[model samples]
Target: MKKLVSLLLVLLVFTGTASAADLSPDVRSAILVDAASGKILYQENIDTPMPPASMTKMMTEYLVLEAIKDKTITWDDIVTTSDYGFFLGRYGGSRVFLNEKERRTVRELYEAMAIYSANDATAMLAEHIASTETAFVELMNEKGQELGMKDSNFITSTGLPRNILSDYAPPISLGEQVMSARDAAILARELINTFPEALKIASTPKAVFRQGEDDQVEMINWNWMLPGLWYELEGVDGLKTGYTEAAGNCFTGTAKRGNIRLISVVMGAKSKEHRFKATKELLEYGFEAFTVEKIAKKGDTIKGYEKTKVLKGKKLEVPVEVAEDISLMVKRDSKIEKVVSLTTVEAPVKKGQVIGSVAFDSESDYLREKDKQDTEINMVAVEEIEKASLIIRLFRGIKNFFLGLF
Candidate 1:
């Protein structure tokens, strides 16, 4: 019986390992994450940086949106094509065939870049914002660092290879624009969270550029998983795609179903079809295997630490409750452990003031170190607690002193 049991255990271990290996996407690097909680569900070689191709435009898009939000520029602002923008628009890898010194509104250029991935439009926007593409490259790197993209290097706003730009290329020493799958996903998350309206353009399947003009062009989005596209995965929406000799094919995709939204990145696929295929696999696995579970609701009191002692308050103890709802994306069958730390507060405490914190740890392997901070929720005062009268405080102090002596 012992020998038979040992053999069964060995088989189970081997099968489990093989199952995990089989689920890894067939790409150079990939990662899937819950958009709300930033929990990593699936990851493979996510930190290895490689050419990101046109996906670099995401940073340009972010900066443009930032400018608009800051009121430094507006969608209706007109931008004239610079010498570099004109040259790149005429001869760059992907373009809308912009004429030298041609003028277009920020809205038009933005649509061209976001929906069509037009390299020239991207370059024009960069120049318009920073007075030069080289200066814009500095802003991109600065923003990347702020976003905690540890393995990313932005050499071009359009993600075009430096050689393609020839003399127009920024004077940066880096050879090319590169980002790891994790960084790409991080950018995607930040972009959508910070500027959700971006999806309005990114999800657009088709549009006309310079409509009804001699140089008009029809722009079709490269993301195939969007609704009404070839792959047409339900709930799949706004994102970006890229391809280059060095980067192969790459995609950052996002989708939402019910209350759960997921972001996925696939880099270095052999073909366009393969990139989307890998993304679909990652999304399906995430949707099927995990769910966002709400462990505590706003105002729910922590069980054992429901009341915290308050010094010099009308009431010696004040009730405390969670400040925000705590939710986490966890495996379907996994168990969760709740750990809490409570603290005392001085009197004159206001309702909603933080007094403690609660953390929920799950028995799953998908959690990452960065996500640790997100799993905790603040505990706050459930109601106001004003300081007691001086006479009452003195009497209470004397009573406590005598009690301590006993």
Candidate 2:
């Protein structure tokens, strides 16, 4: 059985593969991916680079959350609004109307930036974290590179178009911040996976900042397409929005329905409404077209992999079962096919030791030649296999020798 199974694994690995769905979305640059698997479900010019606008704040928000978690900064730590950050003046894209020398807590600044998309508040927070906006932008780029965001170059912590006199950029070069739709999706994925709490603020349509004070102002989230907003889409939580003359209207959003979560990015739409409309269409297309398909469940035995030989063990063989529940986002129209491979191992096998794996692929004849979209899980030993006693091992060796003589 081991010999036969080994031969089958070679065939499955080499001869079997499937292709992805060819979906044409309505947007200049867009991508929809499964948040868990990072699988590209649909894309249109996803690699095309464009200015990301305020979506760049998501990276700032992520770094701030990291500071909070690591104790480098506390939510209640007061941050002073430097004259440079406070005086961006009305000309700056968006602001919380912070006053120079005014102090506020890290939590308030974070809320202001996340909900209001305030450029002023973003600058203050950047200065607080790194003592200067220039140093903070350096941190932003370093983190982006670490996240494998090759196409992202964040010049501003606020994601605003770089301006010569504004603190967001240096006094010299004036260049727009840029990122690809695919890269934005990757950044959003990292943010959500690492700090899910950030979504609570991103999804909120409105909140009060500096409450019950002379400077108190209501900060309404710019993202109106989220749930509880003007145009409600169930499960549409986060993440950020961006717009500049060069970038046009851009949005990077995420939604979760049941066990499946998806990230969608749309860049360079004609208008704010158009960006949201295009994003909504892409997200709807994803949920309408794909579903979570269960490949295997924990403790379930593989049909052909009932047992594997255990050398020098009290038991000659041991039962094997799926170690984890495996599932994948699959096109509803495609059929699922399984490719199983079980490995035979020597004894002293511990319970839960991985001994093999199974992969699931699309069985649609049309996708036979397409790129493979599959998810796999390991098969594990269900029970421990202790070494056999000396007498038992000797008896087995003698028996095998006699059988080989025949």
Candidate 3:
């Protein structure tokens, strides 16, 4: 039987050589990605949109972070749990047991939502940001569109909203915010990439969410794959876990091994073990199968052009180099489709000019190719050494003082 199976596998490969697609039977949908670049190294059914379960929390949590960063809110500010927060807890939604008028700080609420996946806390947070649950949902979807989550829409802050009262009591209607595994992966990547500071808070094993002069709650994070797992795992931090009848076990996992960070998304998994095993397999494959190659250095002048003009600067010309060393790993010997758009950057110019962009396509995605976007991070600006005029320096000081004044 073993020999026959091996022969059958070989025949199947030859039979479908033209299609040249690989998929694992274990997971219903999945994607393995590079966290820094948002590149999909491997995917299976990633674009077949599905209910994202609690993975929806990633978006909700980030919006809260954004609120805090913008000073529209503060972590120490009290979050009053109103009808919305209490209603969610009473109706089978997860909660930190926060009651109406009871308040938790923004920091504590963040821990409750991101670390413990608390439904009441998440709902209350949504209410805090936009003043109403409906408003928060709109904000969630708006941010979703901005982040390229084309398949998602948020009807509730928590993934547990029920339509059963209307007779459509579908077994856990995934997320009102629907998303494909691939888009889900992209969203997860943005959270970690944009707010790396969130990690220090995300990896906590236990959190005291309802601390105050009265009543309290303790939340042990549900993402067991991080601190609880025993493997060569390290730098494996947050994300979220979700489940509803419609959406099976789901997870968005992020980890950093040295300088490299990887994210894995799995939806519709059979069991808890299936998610852990599949994630481990995909990450291990990525770690061993690829490497980063730096093809150019930042501020590298164009090889052929000796110098370029600097606009409005004291210097007439500055040496130009490849803005950055474009580096990406290919399968040990896999040929990559390399295209560099160096022509678009016509800098009058700067040392660190984005003369153009480089993209290497290793393969094509079968899913909607129309929407796939590239993640090309820009390099820092290189300084022009020429000094500013004395008059320019004096004027700069005057401008700084006036700008600093309210």
Candidate 4:
């Protein structure tokens, strides 16, 4: 009995140590989330706003992509370097030197910004779109609000500290820009979903800024976890990294293994190595501990919600099923509860008309309250329902009236 008690104490101590290590990452703030569902898998101090450093450029990247999508600009459009661009090239923290009045295609500048973290190129793209970095910052703030990045503030397009910008800084009095880890994950998830093409430029490990030009420079991606890089991880691709005295070392990284894509943020790490290491730990934990389970198949009716009432239809009701496959990234071996929300529809209902939604509620501690709604999937009609004739409608109204009285 004495020996057994001693062995039990040893096991308890070992289990406690492992739990503590799993909970602690070597960073001031970190978060992990499912990119598809926005379900949070892990988070620590994620809501506290902190300087995001060049991760601010992710927002700049989004706006640039938005401009392209809206036809406000094109990849081949030539933009002349503004005086501000020249000034930043001279003083910006990470830059590809630009001569005043120098001409480059939007694609050129975008690649520089995406792959090299070129502040000059980033600022030039902003000026081309909004005519001034300060005005461009306004657009950033507006989009931030639209995207629900409530904890973010953008002061410079380049994410450079105000001191580095010298007199070229935005006149806003709101102080330095900061974003919470949760907000950063949100932005990253939106970026990939809205502009998946952005990943093409982001994943390029190396490219020449101006091939065969007199002053060409080799641009290497700062996100070193990408393939063929020093800390290469399989499926690691396009994302952003940041560092400043104020922000420490930071990274907003994403990876896709099979059908599961995960977004992770690590902020205020001791060094670049530590940041990537922390991110790798988060990614591995997510991939190993959770899985993308298809809880509801497309066109399959939910058990308790097989049919919904419809007014003015040839048939009084129509069969409804999920419009698309409902997959949730949930803990392995965990049971999921299906929560269905439905609405009544008037007929002339199309075959795939969305009339309701189905969302999963997990009892797992890893999921957060705000992200619960992210798992919701549209429930749609399985077949068309034509409008009822006037006589049929009158009969149905009388029947409903009698049913209500009874």
Candidate 5:
């Protein structure tokens, strides 16, 4: 009996504490994810299609950034308000209230949409990209397709009620802007993963901008997770909050600790209280349930990557690395299983360009080394090794050969 009890105790200890339950009782849907791994850590009704109200703003923000990156627009570029922008502002949608003939810089517009959830700013910003809100909504859908937001559609820049003349008769206000919590989380993850620079703006507690009338409007960030109102979490940054009578309140939050960043999305919560509570629960569950163990430090060699030959390119075999810090947040004491693949071009691997995803299964270590606990793996770029002399390479090869032979 004593031995059996000891064995049972050991088994319980090895299994790690049971993860906190899916505590959300209020929301219609929700998802908690590991942003780095794109793994669904916890989910309930994640794939179900539902109306995505203002949560659609995350995609709008993403499209705006894509346009900026493509040089289709600039921060200082001015967008004149349109009839749509005017109507929305006039009708009391959250707005910067730029007049139909008035102009505001793209930076001001982007912030207004992102920080203040301003519909007029969004419409004007969309016009700057696609010359019309309708066209920008198309661009938003196109980009959503590229990002695999399979269940989503953008009917308007402001996510306002717009009557559309469908195959039926008179124009009807869109009954729904469909999206899945998982798809929404995926888009939010892409926005942060692609343009980390936006964090500097999104995380701000407040932003001040002058409208076309030179009115200095104080745009207090609508995100509730900033300094004054947040828990003692570090590296929390800007994402967007969304709400509509149909969608309820939703929030997509992204935070970084050390080098590990994560995105969380909670939707369909009954009230602002549920929204905030559920989000905090997701973040806490993510951070507390698993441990991010760093395995390989920067400048460390990635085994097997050196031996893989690059088929063709201007350079030779490029060093394929886990460019960012590779962390495994696993059940304590559970091993991590990682499979690395090279997703680079068909030939010479360059310094950067998604080589491949390192598939980590069931929370395992990224890299295992003697004495040192597996932390995170920082990648070494190919350019750094490109400069090594032939003699040094040959000598290293000879040493490795001898070690293997022995």
Candidate 6:
């Protein structure tokens, strides 16, 4: 009876303190980050670069969304399929089977690319937007650099194997698209933040491409974490999945439970099932271990934010405000300290001008080691402080001069 009790105690201890270390995922790299704060929750080989199959489409999606935002393109805009795009689909790659000279709307192509992972549709959209796939690839690389994705290099819109386009007799090995797990998370966050509507498209479990009376193509979303898939989990919504001979199986997944959102990236997994399994583990660990709380709202006045003296303005001083909402993810049941600091602003201050910052800190060694304990939030001026009239300015200058002499 005592031995049985001891065995049960050991099981309880392991279950209570379970972490990522307890599970072994057959993947080359993986990472999980708090979608709101971009704080890494769990990681393994996050910096190692691996092939990024169709995951490259996220950048393509970003550019398409940007163009729409700037009015350069619209969802209703007709995209004329180029010969290059047609040939890519014509050849044996995954596509919506776009014929040469086929005309499709921007929205249709985006759905194909985002939902079906259609290589032809991706190339078609790229050519329509940039006049050529090569130019679109250049844009993708530029955006990657802008996003600080140091370990990523995008040579194609589709994450297809490099040699697929090669004419070499011996099939000379060309470099494939590569990205670190950390870089993938950064890219995913940017995608969801910039055009959250894209998630609506990605969340679909199955969609019909070019739905019509003729040649209707049935497209299934590759993300198994979404509903109706083998690994369906509540709250799992968006993301992209990729696979290639070189890349193995990869997935960039995100889920929101209440106010907390998480982004998980798994790359180079042994199989399709393994990649989704690994991602689920990371996400479950994050949701189980941490909770995100809204510490402050944007424009909320910080307690004790004293009015700053203004040299020449309509009012003698102005109230300070938070520039943006502040939210932090901390370990469950852990306590933290919020430290607010203010900086005095000079006259001629404009509304929303940053002046100070608030920081969160803790003495917990575990929090410090995980690099999750401390963070800073910026403060801004709530109201504008106009410059005084020339006569008033001159009078103040003379008064200041006399005061300085005294």
Highest lDDT among the candidates is held by which one? 4
Q: Give the Cα lDDT of each candidate.
A: 0.83, 0.78, 0.66, 0.84, 0.66, 0.78
* Candidate 1 Cα misplacement greater than 4 A, ranges: 1-22, 172-175, 310-316, 346-351, 362-374, 383-406
**Order the candidates by TM-score, highest first — what do you get?**
1, 2, 4, 6, 3, 5
Instruction: Write the residue-wise lDDT of candidate 5 on 183-248 in tens digits.
Output: 888887788878876777788888776834466788877777777754424556868787777778
Tens digits of per-residue lDDT for model 4, 338-359? 6577778887889989888876
Q: On residues 1-406, what C-alpha lDDT tens digit does candidate 2 reach at each position? A: 2432632322121211222343444567988888877777777787777888888998899999999999999999999878876676355677778887888899988998998888888888888899988889889989988887878777778776655444435644534478898789888988998998998888888888889998788977788787677757878988888888788888998999888898999998888888788777777777877777665689988676788877778898889888888776667655556666776677788999988877665332211122133366777999999988999999889999999999
Q: What are the RMSD figures for all models against the true structure?
A: 7.8, 5.5, 14.2, 9.5, 10.8, 10.9
- Top TM-score model: 1
Candidate 3, residues 1-406, lDDT tens digits: the string is 0010100111001111111143353778888887755666788877787877788888888898899889999999898888767666666455677777877788877888888888888878888899976677778888888787767766677776466212322234333557788878877877887888777777877777655646667777767767764432566786778887788888888787766778888899897677777777777666666555554456644333444434334553455444545555334434445333333222234446543443445253422333233423343335544555768657767988999995
Q: Which stretches of candidate 5 lie over 4 Å from their true place?
A: 1-18, 163-175, 211-214, 230-234, 295-326, 333-335, 338-359, 362-406
Clashing pairs in 6: none
Worst 10 residues of 2 by lDDT: 7-16
Alpha carbon RMSD to native, model 4: 9.5
Off by over 4 Å in 2: 1-25, 164-168, 171-176, 212-216, 312-316, 361-375, 388-406
What RMSD value applies to candidate 6?
10.9
lDDT of 6 by residue, 242-295 (tens): 988889899999999988899999899889899988888888888887776677
For each candidate, give its TM-score against the true structure: 0.86, 0.83, 0.73, 0.82, 0.70, 0.76
What is residue 13's positional error in candidate 6, in angstroms?
20
* Better by lDDT, candidate 6 or 1: 1
Q: Summing lDDT over every window of 10 consecutive residues in candidate 6, give the lowest-scoring window.
A: 1-10
Model 1 whole-model lDDT (C-alpha atoms): 0.83
lDDT of 4 at 76: 98
